[model samples]
Every structure is written in structure tokens, then in C-alpha cells.
Target: MLDHCNGHPLAIIALGGVLATKKSLDEWESVCKNIQSHLQGDEESYSGVYDVLAMSYYDLHYNLRPCFLHMGHFPEDSRIDVEKLYNLWIADGIVSSTQDQIGKERSLEDIADDYMNQLVQKGMIQVNRKVSDGRISSCSLHDLMRDYCLEMTREENFLQIMYIDEQQNASADALTDKARRVTMYVGKEDGQSVLKSLSGKFSSLRSLMFISTSTEQDEDEDSCEWIRTLCRRFKLLRVLDFEGRVVLKGTFPSEVGNLIYLRYLCLKGTRITELPSSIRKLKSLLLLDLRVSRVIIKLPNVLSEISLCWLYFPVRILSQEYDNTQGYEIEDGSQLILNKLSHLERVSEVDLDKVDVKSLLERTSMRNLSATCRQKKESLVPFLKSSTIKHLSLKIDAGLLTGNSEMLLSKSSSLRILHIDAGSWPVTQLTIRVDMFPCNLVELGFWYCKLSEDPMPVLEKLPNLRNLQLHICYGGVEMNCSDTSFPELTYLELDGLFFLNFRNVKMGGFPKLLEMAIYNCPLQKIPDALHPGINILCSSILDPLANEYRLRGKASEEVQIPNLNTASEEDQMPKLCEFPLLVLAIIPFVMLSFYFCRSKKH
Candidate 1:
């Protein structure tokens, strides 16, 4: 059966999936015979591959059929954000909240995740990257499978995609009115021209996206104008995404308020200064992302009218031209408006200096928070002790931990991921002990803490930790890891500890480690126990050392070894005698030749 696949990955995977449930060899033989009967066409044509994929598609559960078809809405070879995709699925009404076997209701996001996992099991989707807690962060589709999806979508009128280039003439007439979702791929230089050509009304469109090929181009002031025109045309849009693609500078379009049915709005990495006053009319808005925007928007009081579940704003001023006040709302007046949103769940990054943490935490349902504190007296104690927060990232001044604030996180049982960065003021004292962390943490990171103690001893005791990163955080010369330490650790990184020693790691340490990265740390040797089946990244100076360890283990990993064969050959050759001996020998010969030449001349 495998031999008949012609080494086509999709066909092989689909056949494997089809045969996975056959318990006995006879059953497998029967299935193989049936598959061979269907694969009786020309191998050069992909008809056999398509037939296999079609079987997989038809085998999908009725609920997953639409979810699989939705993959056609994205451009080719794109890594789709898992959260964004899930949210879009929910907004499109294909995935809905459901009750579990135990009668507990599961959120639509959870259901979508399970759907994605099932697709992955069926081998239709590929996982691209995973988060620290073992959840898929992003995913991509195989080229052949994507082609199949596009074919299916066209037959079903599920989506329409326009690729606008300099040579292609894209006009309103080019699009079909049946496509409910439209994704336009255009280069930054020609974005305006493409927008003008797409002036035709899309009455049936519910989702729209603009993906720019060039991201570093300067902001075109007219980009927002076209969006305003688009808003007037597509009043029924549910999802409007410009995530990290096109840059919308100047004011956000007021016409966007006309999208009353909008559920998801993304302006991430844009140059927009503020949300339009008319945006308060989007009562159905669920997620509003403004992360890394040019200026920290002065959220209007009318923002409280919407029920947002995910709201992400900039933590710092991304543009150098903007002043401190422009990037952060130091005034506490408008900041208090966050407390009134009853449905707000996820937010990044609120400035600690301006927000009243107690009120914000007490009034809202935020579970993921990214906050920064530049002030001298602000405390992280409230955030660390919150049992509700599952993921927390804090960039704060070291002085905030002057008192008993260091032990606050021990009470945070629900916190899964924590990162504390004190890189701004390294001169101050920032103490982090093992007892100060929660036992349930799945990922932890420290930056520029400059601790005098070896953090490995304490961090290893974190039984659930899966990922750990330390960048200029340790100041010690030697660090130790006991046997069986970090039993569950999968990823480890060490950077900027210039004088650390690595010989102290015990034989059984890091038993589950899969990846390790060492940067700018000049270690004489790596521990012998850490040499097998681990992906290692290091500076060029340490490449030879790592490869030597791999060779000692007879590992087949490839590494570059610098060549010095010619230099060694040159050193092995004979050399001339000392200057005095050579001069004497040359003088005697010269004297004989000179005497003979003189006699002949005479």
C-alpha cells in the first residue's frame, strides 16, 4: 500500500489514517486492497492523491467540515495564529460552545481547540509552533492539502482570495458575490491601487483581511482613507484584520463604527493614535487588539459600552518621536474606565503607575495580564497573588520588591506562565528564590535579575516547569543541578553569564530536556549526560565543542569543523640552518668559485 503512494506525503498520510483503526493484519490487508483498486490511474496526475484526500475530507465529522474548509480563507504558506483562527471560527458561527460528557459547558475556544487537534490527528493540518504550556500557537497547511481545500471551497463558495500584483488587473468585477469571506494579498507599494480597484460592494462578505507583503515600508497616510471607504460598503463585516500587515497611521477611521456586527478587530503593530469616538457603537466587539501601536490610545469612556473578552494595548511607546505622556496615560482619570467593562478577560499591557490595580482586579474578569511598572514605589504583590491570572508578564523596577513582595507568587496556584524582566535598572537588587515561585508554573523567565545565588537549584524543584530562560540573570561562577532534577523540563536557555562552570550538573539531571541554548557563556566543557538526543544552539566558538561531544556519543548530527590541514603540512617541512652556519658554508663555496674564476680570467 505504501509503495503505491508514489512517495506523496498527503496520500501516504491519508492512507495511514484510513488504516489506523483496522485491528488485525487481515483487516489491514482488506483496506489496502480496496485502496489499490481506487488508485488505478496514472501516477503522474495527482488524481490518486486527490482521491485519497477526498476520502479524508469526507471522513471528517460533520462539525469539523466547515472548520477544515475555513483554511482556504488564508493565503498560501502562511502561518495562521491559532487564537486568531479560533476566534474567527467562533465569529463565523461554525464553532459554538458545547456541553461536555459530564454536563459542564465548554467555551467555543476550547471546542475549537479540540477540533484542531482532531484535524491534526487526521493528518490534514500541520503544527508549526507550540506555546510553553503545550498548546498549539500557530499552524500551517501542506501545499497539496491547501490546494485541495481551495478546490473544495470554490465548489462550495466558502471563500474568495485575490492576489494583487503589478501585472494582475484586480477589479470589482473579478470577485464573485457568493464568497462570504475575502482575503486580499497585496504588496505595500501597490496597496492603495489594489484598494481602489476593489471598490465594488461585497454585500455577502462577513470577514475581510488585508495582508501586505512588505511590512517595513513607511506608513501611507491614505491607507486609512480607503478603509473608511470600505467600512461604508461592508456594513455587515464580523471580522476586520490588519494584524502586523498594513500600517494605518493618523486617526483611526470613524466610519468603522458602522460595522455594528463586528466581533473581532485587530490593529496590531499599526501607527494609529487613538480609537475613534464612534467605535463605542460596536456593541458586539469581542476582541480589540492594539498591541505595539504607535501611541497608547487614550481609551474613551464610551469604551465601557462594549463587551470585550480580549483587549490588548501597547505596554510601551513604540515610536521614538512620541513623548512619555503620548504613549502612556499617566493620568488616572481615563484609566479607571477599564474597571467598568464586565466582560473583559485578557489584557496586555497596562501601566502599573496609572492603573488602580485593586479596583481593576476587583471589577473585571481579566485572567492574562502583562503590566509594566517604571515608578519607584509601585508593587507587583497584587498581581502575583491573584489566583485568577493564568498568565502574567511583569517588567518592573527592582525596587518594587524591597519588602515581603518577593513571596507573593507562591499563592498564585492558577498561574501557568510567569516572566519577570528587570533589565531596565540592573544596578538595583532583585532577589528570586525557589520558594518565591508557584509550584504549578509551566514556564518561567528572568531577565537581568543579577542574582548572586545559583537559580538552577531552586528552579529545578519546580516540578511542573516546562520552559526556562535566564538572560544576564545569574552572577555566580558555578551552578549545580542534582540528580533527577528538572524531571519535566523540556526547554532551557542560558545567556550572558560570562564566567559560569557547567561540570556540576549530575548524571541524571534534565532527563526530559529536548532543547538547550547557550549564548555568550564561555564554558570550558558541557556535562556528559546532556549530550544525547538534545537540540543544542551555541555561539560559533562553541560549535566545535558541541560537535565533539556529539561525536563521542556516535551521534549522526552534522556540524562544521574548521580545517587547518594546509597549516599543519607547512609546519612539517624542513627549515634552513641558523644564519651563521649557512653564511660559513656559502662563504667557502663562494671562495672556491671566486678563486677559480679569477685564475681563468688571468
Candidate 2:
């Protein structure tokens, strides 16, 4: 018997076998002896013996067989909280009678402890001790053991379906008998009636997921009504996910508020913009994912006051009522409302593209700001000057940075990180006077700017420069002049510049350079003299490397050539055989040439 059931023979016999003889001392003794004999036959018999003894003792003490059946509820590979387990046991009334002879001497907790210890010794349960709480907090089951438990403990008449893809009538016919859990993905045509049928059949369902796979264009009112009814009926749903476009055209049903027990609500890529106001009623909601949902109109004003540990929403100004200001508010003071969220230390990103930063700067206090400007450069002057900002990102039209370079650099002095996204042919040169720029700057990024001159002059002035990025800066810019070196630079990135070259720039000499990334530059032959410690990353090395080379032509004339005879060895030699010998050789050579010419003429 022990060999047939590993160590869980008691649960198996109690759940599967008929009553053995009668419920008496003699019958229990006989059963225990038989189990013990079976265990004694194997060398791996210790665990089997313990299981038999614990089960027999439990049966003798607690008459109901269902008391031991509840252990199968713990999921495999997951820990069971001791307090929760104990509470569930008490609620199920699994305790032995106090009037019984064997039960009178022990408390139910003690009996449960003994059973747990026996299970541990029999290799059925693994106990985990949490050090922080100083308690035995959890119990886990092995896969094999859990499967055995499920097999022995599950009701014989229970139904299990893996995947269901049928019409509503077919599904309804199949679900006529009570099923434990049903999982089905619905097509657009059948999405409505299928959900209605499922809601009626499976009220006690543990999980329901309606995955829409259709690419249908039109969503009718019946579909929305079907979803509304499903949300109402599945009040006890633990996990609800609308994977595809399951839009709620009208407001969500107020009855959806009853899903208070929902743990995960994922509405990824849905067109539904606004959540029902009743969404605030879900106090137990742990994860609410509304990514890529275009229909969200506005987040509730009370959201800032709630103690939500996780939230994702479009960046907006906080309400003004939370601010300490009263009747003295300005007429266009909507920008001032962002100040109310100053206490939100957990907010990591803020986009102030459309808001009036002049008003917001007076009240708002943010540590990280990502702003996109639809207005002119002067309108963003106040936000650039913010002292609380640590990271600043700007995506503005090219004209904003033209004459405002001084103003931009002035406000940048307090910034540690800066990202500027400018348009093509930016009104201003991508050059800066480094002397007045921020000394604390660590990272600088330039995007889509026409940079014809070297950017090193400003870069070298930054004492704390660590990262530099240039994207789409065209017009054949070569990095020359090693005078302005980044001593603390770690990362250098260049991307999407067709004519940018990194050769002969002597970038290898950067003392602290760690990583370099070059992509889509279409260049061959990187500078052979790169820093040995620096790591180079590029797409390919080819003739495209010529794109980074800068061209220059000569603007002046050449010097006159000198006569070779004037600087001969004879002139320099110190009177070798006297000057008369040199004159005699010259006279003879001249006379012989004259005599040969006279003979030719005669």
C-alpha cells in the first residue's frame, strides 16, 4: 500500500477506498498494522511509516475524512502562509471533538503542529523560516507530491478542460455539468453570447480570461453589454485580462465595482479611454495595467491623495486645492496646480509639453522633468531655470535655441543631465561657450542638429562630463584637436550620422573612456589609436568611414626653387688641390667644346 502511494496512502485510502471493516478501535488497529507491515518491506520506509502513523492517529481522533483533504489546496512550488492556513482550517471546522478520549488531552493547534511535523519528516512538506518575522511562515510541496495530492483529493466527478474554442451553444452544452474551471478564447462574432453563457454556467469560476483574436472593425452595442454582464456576474473573479481591443464604448457598469477581490486587471492596448469612476472602489486591486489605452480622458483628482504603491498616467498638473495657496490664485493659474504634487517623491517622469511652465515654475517642484515644447524658446526659460530638476529633456522646434543659447546655457548651470531634441537646420549652431556652462554637468545629448563645427570646445570644459551622445548630427563633422579631452568620460555614442568619422581623432587617449557606440555611420576603419581600455561598438567597418572625413583646400602659393650648382661640393670643399686646379679643368673643358664646334662648321 505504501509502495503504491509513496507516503500519502492515508489521504488516498480515506478519499478513494471504502470503509475498512467498521469505525472502531479494533478496525483502526488492524489498518495501522497492515500499513506498518507494508512500510517495513522497503529500505526507504521511514517516511511511509510516519505517514501511516499520522493518518491513522488523525482518523482515530477526527472522525471526518475531509479534515485531511484540505491540505491539497496549497499550490505546488508556492509557499502557504501559516496564519492563513490555520484560519482556513478553523473556518472549515476541522478540529477534533473535545469530549473524545484521544482529543481531550491536546489542542487543535498542537494536533496541526504534529501533523505538519509528521508531513515534514515524511518528505511531503517543506517548511521555510522567515528571519525577519522570526516565524515558520510557509510550507511548500514538491511537484510529484502535489500531483499525487491533487489526484487523491480531487472529487471523482469533477471536470477539467484545457482549452475551449466552440460556439456558445456547444460551450453551453459542454458546461451543463458543474466544471471546476473553464478557459476559452472568444472570436468577435461569438464574444458576446459566449461570455453570457459562461457567466451563467461558471459563477464559482476561479479565473476567466477573454482573449480577443479577431481584427474586426465594428464593435456593436451587444458586445459592450456582454462585457458589462460578464463583469457583473464574475464578482468573485481573481484575475481578469482583456488582451486585445475589448472597448467599453459607454461608461463601465457600476456593478463592476463589486469585483473588489480582483488582484490583476490588465487592459493592454484597449481603446477604452476612461475608467469608470467606480474603479476607485477596488481597494484590493494590486496591479492595474492600462498601457496603450487611448480613451483615458483624465485621471481622477483624488489620485494624488491615494496611497497607491504603483500608478501610470499621462503627465499632468496636480490640483491647486492641495496647495497652501487660497484666494490669491492667478486667472491662468492652471500651471500652478502642479505644485500640489511636490510631495510625491515616487513620481519619476513628468512631461510638461502643453502646460504654461512660467506659471508652473512658480509652484511646481519636480526632480525629473521630460518636456516637449509646442511654444517658442522664451516660453520654456522658466522651466530650464528650475533648481529642483536633476534630469531635463527638451524636444522643441529648432528656432527656440537660436538667439537663446545664452539663456539656455545660463539655466543649464544647475542641471546635471540634459537632452535636447531640435529640428533640422536648427537656427543656432550646436556650439556653446563652455566657460559659462554648468560645471556639474555629467550627461549631454544632442539630437537632429546641424553640427558643422567641432563640439569638443564645450565638452572639454565640463569637469564632470561622463556621457556624451550625438544623434543625426550631419554635415561631415570630424572630431579633431585633443586639447579638450573628457577626463571623466565613460560613454560616448554616435548614431544615424551618415558622414560622421571617429578616425584619427585620438579618442583612445581619453583616460577614463569605458564604452563607445557608433551605429548607422557607414564607416570603415576606426581610428587605429583608440584607448586600449575603451570598448568600441559599431555596425560595420567599410568605405562609409570616409563620410566622417572633413575636407580643406590650400589658399596660398608655393616658395621659389633653389639652384643645385650654387650649393655644390666644390664650393663647400676647402681648396682641395687649390683653386688653380679647378680653373685649369674648367678652361680645358671650355676649349675642347669650342674646337669640336669649329670642326663641324668647316
Off by over 4 Å in 2: 1-343, 346-349, 356-366, 376-398, 402-414, 423-429, 435-437, 481-484, 532-537, 540-602
Model 2 poorest 10 in a row by lDDT = 550-559
Q: Model 1 reaches what TM-score against the true structure?
A: 0.79
Query: What TM-score would you give candidate 2 relative to the actual structure?
Result: 0.44
Candidate 1 residues lying further than 4 Å off, grouped into runs, are 1-7, 18-45, 101-103, 171-174, 215-223, 315-333, 356-359, 362-397, 501-503, 523-526, 539-602
Task: Write out the backbone clash pairs for model 1.
Answer: none
Q: Score candidate 1 by lDDT.
A: 0.68
lDDT of 2 by residue, 1-602 (tens): 44534645544443223235346877655664566442322335345644444444343334233333444554346666664444334333454314347553343444545555544544445676431112356777655455545544444312233223444443422343354434354555444656545644665764454445445754553334566677777787655656444554444455666787765565554544445657667765544544423343333333333222223333222222221211112223343233333322222223354344553464333444545443455656776676765555554544455665555655574555656654332223455567535677677777655554667655765788777887765445466536347777877887765555555455434577666676656445555455554555543222132122211111121111121111233333425444665465346334433443343366
TM-score per candidate, chains pooled: 0.79, 0.44
Error of 1 at 32 (Å): 8.6
